[model samples]
Target chain A: MNGFKIIVLAKQVPDTRNVGKDAMKEDGTVNRAALPAIFNPEDLNALEQALRIKEAHPGSTLTILTMGPGRAADIIREALFRGADDGFLLTDRAFAGSDTLATSYALAKAIEKIGRPDLIVCGRQAIDGDTAQVGPQVAEKLGFPQITYAEEVNIEGDVVRVKRRLERGIEIVKASLPLLITVNGSAPECRPRNARMVMRYKKATTLTERQSANEDYLRMYTSHPYLNIEEIGFKDLDANIDDCGLAGSPTKVKKIENVVFQAKESMVMPATDHHLDALMKELIINHTLG
Target chain B: MNNIFVYCEVEGGVIADVSLELCTKGRKLADQLHCQLEAVVIGANLSGVEKQLYPYGVDVVNIADDPRLEPYTTLPHTSVMIQLIREEQPQIALMGATTIGRDLGPRVSSALHSGLTADCTSLEIGDHEDKKNEKVYKDLLYQIRPAFGGNIIATIVNPDCRPQMATVREGVMKKEILSKHYVGTVKNLEVSRYVNDSDFVVSVIERHMEKSKVNLKGSSIVITGGYGVGSREGFDQLFELASVIGAEVGASRAAVDAGFADHDRQIGQTGVTVRPKLYIAFGVSGQVQHVAGMQESSMIISVNNDPKAPINAIADYVIQGDVNDVVPKMIKYYKKNTK
Candidate 1:
């Protein structure tokens, strides 16, 4: 059996899970600068699945493809440090404010540009949006079958078996080659970065970054061609400008507001046995509790 | 006809609660827009399924009963839904935000070039003014949901899309029967016409779908823990207290993610929306997402060391203490006060 060509889609998202007091602006918008940017957690799980497949296939190669600002290349490097062979950064001003559908269109176009692979794996959803729509939408755009909420994936010959973690149960399904899989967060966490891999790919930079690189780094890029991460922008793809970004997105945000609760004049009570007994007695008498 | 269409999910020959909940909401939206409410159920042995839907004020029920359709596969379901939606030209389309709906909604929306919002907390019929386009659109479906990790609420609209699509999680909307005597027409679909042979490429090899054991929504009193609970053993105290008081145990996403509780026990914007008579929080520094689920509780009592915990703002009783200390005391007093 030949090794499969696999691509893992990843995102660099703000750590919204541990949002701090400074995480939100006074105007109710996310303060991106205050939040630390890291590789989306589920996407890392997807990367782990991709890496496992690569290890199993011996000659297989895993590529990371991410769409965001130039800084998103950080996650690509992060993936390379964890055993990916190479990566591509899809960035352009045209892709700003893209909803799930438009983002899928742009990613599908980039995938085509990278040449269709045997399998495409990505997290079920991005933390920031939590839509869980991109993976299936991309599969639909590329005319491939999708297996979502996959906790485990194994390939035998041209057939791929996936174990999906549904809300209430588990299911094992099988499909042929050329498929897309959206891994659930319940999947195994990604392996830690290898020291050797990090030393080798630490200087990996996209063309945009290369232009802004120091002289010594520029010379190293010439010597080590692999360090030059491929950068794909709007000009490189045949995607219609209208269908690649905010213009192509059908959903529009009409308004955004900070979550505010109607505050109750709460009766503060000390954590004393007396207060506890009284509270319980009061609840029992009022039939609020027994 | 430009009616409201809900893509009902069926499992084990029964319509999912989320789908019925959407039907209830859809019926309301249909009434507001003065359009018929329609339901599309695709699965095996769906005979007389419309009987279950009509009481929700559904005007029409579309059934595609095929053996291969049960145990949903993405391609076939998407094909059936897309073809049906295109033919009906519904002004609005809604679905459950379960694993099946999250998978199928995007594909169908992508194929039709329509927009889809997932896990919407609220749906409303309203008008939108596109100031840039200088256009006023009436009766647009407003898809309201918490975004950016549930710190903010956003109202989304698809002004130009033919069928505005949105997916709501189970229990987010109330399920009410309009009338038991309500009647609806049934339209049986020829499954082969909408789905192709290639659509069955993915085959289910094995399946074990157990009914969810947790009954958070049905519980009258809920005792919940957050990450501050410290460890899984820390949650044992909560369970002990719940058993003594005849209450159900719930957890915030943080606690569940920390492995203190199972995902099914999660309560938040992404999890179950519960409105119990009494909600007691232990060590919960509430994020808006968590509060969104339980704020409707008739009485909220928060126990935490942090006096400024966001949950305390909405809590009717703010008990300043640690769960480790307060939980045992509450359990002791409950036993003492009871017969």
Candidate 2:
């Protein structure tokens, strides 16, 4: 019932929505240069849940923690525009190509450095990987319980009640404090940026971004420390280099292939099902069901 | 080489559909690896259900029955599976990519210091070579899946880890019953003894059933929209067209991400995989992830302003017009025709 410290985990992903023909290279790897980077869709859903909890608990503080390149600081600014107190960008070359395991390890180290939080909210999965492993893995590494596919959450006494969306139906569950919950895309959609907050924090920059900024803006970020989003690297979290990125990942991608199903296997039909009776019977006979 | 183990999940006293699909795939993989195809079911009082395994190509079935395991919390299931895999040392283990499997697979694999590939669509037994490193790992579990939202396919291999694991989505493979052969064996286990009360950190307080208004799986005609639907009002036109064609309304991940529709109605990877007799897309440009789930529909019709949308490639009929402009016309024409 009291105010609690909350951390929201977000990611900056390629805007695959506007995928072009050249989205992938001959090697099957993503052509990062061609696509624009945007906030992961579900992570915005996660931040909305965190914002909801913060709204209910008046004095609660919500912080954004994301692990990506320095440009990932954009997500922090995005979060701040929607009412987050602070954020940290876990960036460094060492964190590249990290599978869920290594990604969780580095994130867990970052979480530990931030100290104990009453709740940790993350999206069910990132659009890029679609693994859904990092959330539970961080809970395992942190020795805290986790609730996945959470549709709704609320505070009751010291226990956080969560309604989980399972394949069959919904189940309401309860757990103690210091728990992690992965928000589903089914959760409430996030609010658009507030015009006032956007105008206020539009000048926010990280130390890395400041390197490319003009002198006047650098002086402004220094004068208003809040304008400088905190940036942490591998050394800051004390993460082992062996367990931070590609080196720590166990799974290896051996090959990539392009696939396009043949339309010739299917028949072209007009919008009107004028031959409805015949089509239905044919589908039934073919075991497509009546 | 060791046997391949498929963990069967039971719901409402019946085996899940994905489990049976696992048996079909496991049997093929087992034969390729020269080992037996084994299955393990964890639930309460699942005595007669072991009979269902042999018909699905399982040569051996193991049941860990416990009343506490009925609804399935994370720890009790993970404990039994970890113990079972350690004892059998199966070279490959598989589970469905359901809510339970996704939560449990990562924990189990991490605890065992192995690797897990989630949402794999294809599995094969073959050699994996790191072409860049010039190293070849022979006879590995070739775990193949859609990466970067199905734009590309990546075949992964956990060469050094024992018991390579994967969680496959339902309906990815057709399930078939193999005739009872060679009198299969069954073993009842007492795995509940290993689980403690502390293991269940989060307990179910209540259960609520929110059956969707439209069952996308059972509907014969499906009308799907994508981000191109634009807004919530745009999605209303989609429902109007669905009502005219007697089709269930569905959305692509794009629409769901755009907050124009609910998640359950989203048709694609991480959402429901639907194979209706007729699938119509309105203003929907199909992403690879969305196409992976709905490409099997009998008659696919795509409507979009852009002629080169990916969904257009797989569509049987392509209409190059904005969905907003076209859907209302379809509704008016259908209303004029015979009911």
Candidate maximizing TM-score = 1
Model 1 error, position B147 (Å) = 1.0
Give the per-residue lDDT digits (tens) of candidate 1, residues B192-310.
Answer: 99999999999999999888889999999999999899899999999999999999999998898789999999998889999998999999889888887898999999999999899
Docking class of 2: acceptable
Window of ten residues with lowest summed lDDT in model 2 chain B: B330-339
lDDT string for model 2 (B70-166, tens) is: 7878767877888888888999999999888899888777667567899987899998777777888878999988888778778898877778999
Model 2: how far is B122 from its true place, Å? 1.9
Model 2 regions more than 4 Å off:
A20-29, A55-59, A191-203, A212-228, A263-290, B180-183, B210-213, B218-250, B258-262, B275-286, B297-339
Expressed as tens digits, the lDDT of each residue in A1-290 for candidate 1 is 76989999999999888877888888878899999999999999999999999999988889999999999999999999999999999999999999999999999999999999999999999888899999999999999999999999999888899999999899999999899999999999999999999999998999888887788888888899999899999999989998878899999999998978899999999999999999989888988785
Spell out the clash pairs found in candidate 2.
none
Candidate lDDT scores, in order, read 0.93, 0.83
True contact recovery of candidate 2:
0.56
- Among these predictions, the greatest lDDT belongs to 1
Candidate 1 regions with alpha-carbon error over 4 angstroms: none
